[model samples]
Target: MSNRGGVVKTLFKRDFVYTFYSWGFYVVLFAAFMISSFILKNFLDGIREEDILVSAYPLNYPLFISVIVISIYLVMLSGVSISREREHGTLEVLFYGPVTAGNFLISKYFKDLCLGIIALAFCAVYFYLVSLTTNLGFTAGLVRALVMGVFMISCVVCFGLFISSLTGRTRSSVLVLLAILGGFLALQFVHAALIGMEREALSTPMLYLRETVSHLFRGINWVSPFAFLNRGLDAVVLDSPLLFGLNIFYAVVYSVIFLILSIISMSLKGVKA
Candidate 1:
């Protein structure tokens, strides 16, 4: 147990420190904040009254956009890093030490999770400045959304790692990640659109299509990180304790299941295979 503990500590420190100092993380942070600033600027511009009920408001939309943007980058980063490391013989070298797939994966998961939290901290600071400038005081809703953001990030990175574990090469990982995420987004978009329409307005074929997509969406609730994101945001927005707690529980279960699958996938494939 002590040996495994040491292994996780060593690997976590090594990878975390390296990635922390890398320019990529900082670059992503700048990009996310820039986009957030652009969004809030337009939003404030539209409502140009000083006393227009701007104070003590929720910045959920900008925050939502920022989280989605950062998540896309982090997901790709996780997938590519794992796949590339495997290709370059990094994992093989690490495995020769006391490292096993389980601890190694846990280290990766935590390293990325910590990075996500750092990004969220930057988010807090960025939004704080926005609140100060726009006189839109950050309220409890933003805080709740940020708390929900943590679990969303976990599910996202774990999903990326799971995809990476299933593929051998970095190129394959990238391709698969894009394809799968694209499909998931398409499903959500079409599903929401169809469901928003009046039931009587739909043609016979459209009704059947909506039903099919509905079933598919339900099937993917457990498999899709975006589904988790949607549920998390809904729970926070509703301000329901029951829904919020349930979302957290579901996120944890989803993350754990994916992490275990990633470890098992790596074990089955071995380093070089």
Candidate 2:
């Protein structure tokens, strides 16, 4: 038991160091903060000179944006970690040591989750500074959203690892991950559009197609990590503790299912350079 813990810790430390020492993670954080600042400035400017902007949690939107940015970076980092190790023969070499598929993938998942937590900390500090400058209230809702982000990031990391385990090359893994995520986003947009359209304006065939897409979109909500984040964020905005707890449960289930699939894939595929 101690030996297994040591192995996971060692791998986790190595990946964590590599992630922070590289420029990619910092670049992503910088971009997120800049975008948040830009949006906040414009939002503050839009208020009428005579009118006051009363917001319960103005920072929640920026926090969500930051989470999205960090999630993308960490997901890509998780995918690239496994694929790059395989491409460079590191994984195969490690397999000759005490490493197993379970520990290896868990370490990667933990490393990315840790990175996400660090990013969340940075976001907290960033938003605090923004609030100091802009008077945008940092309420309890922002804290809830940040807490929810941890679960959302677990889902993202597990999903990325699953994709990485399936592909031999780093490029293929990233491409496949992007393609699937893009498809999910496109499906969601189409479903929203269909829902917003006047039912009477649509022909019978169009209505049938819309119904099919709506069902597909509903299914995707269970599979997509972003959907979990969205649901959690909505729950926070709505102040619904029941919905928030349910979303957290769903996120945990999603993470566990994907993590198991990732481990199984790695075991079946073996380590190849």
Which candidate has the top score in lDDT? 2
Q: Which residue pairs clash in candidate 1?
A: none
**lDDT (Cα, 0-100) at 90 in candidate 2:** 94
**TM-score (all chains, Cα) for each model:** 0.93, 0.96
The C-alpha stretches of model 1 lying farther than 4 A from their native spots are: 49-56, 196-198, 201-203
Rate residue 19 of model 1 by lDDT.
Answer: 92
Give a tens-digit lDDT track for model 1, residues 1-273.
698888898888999999999998999889888888888877787676553645344578889888888788879877876787888899899889888989988888999999999999999988988888876888788998899999999999999999988888899999999999899889989999999999999999999999999999998888988788888888877889899999999999999999999999989988873
What is the alpha-carbon lDDT for the whole of candidate 2? 0.89
Alpha-carbon lDDT, every model: 0.87, 0.89
142-195 per-residue lDDT for model 2 (tens digits) = 889999999999999998999999888999989998999999999988998999
- Number of clashes in every candidate structure? 0, 0
Error of 1 at 57 (Å): 3.7
Candidate with best TM-score: 2
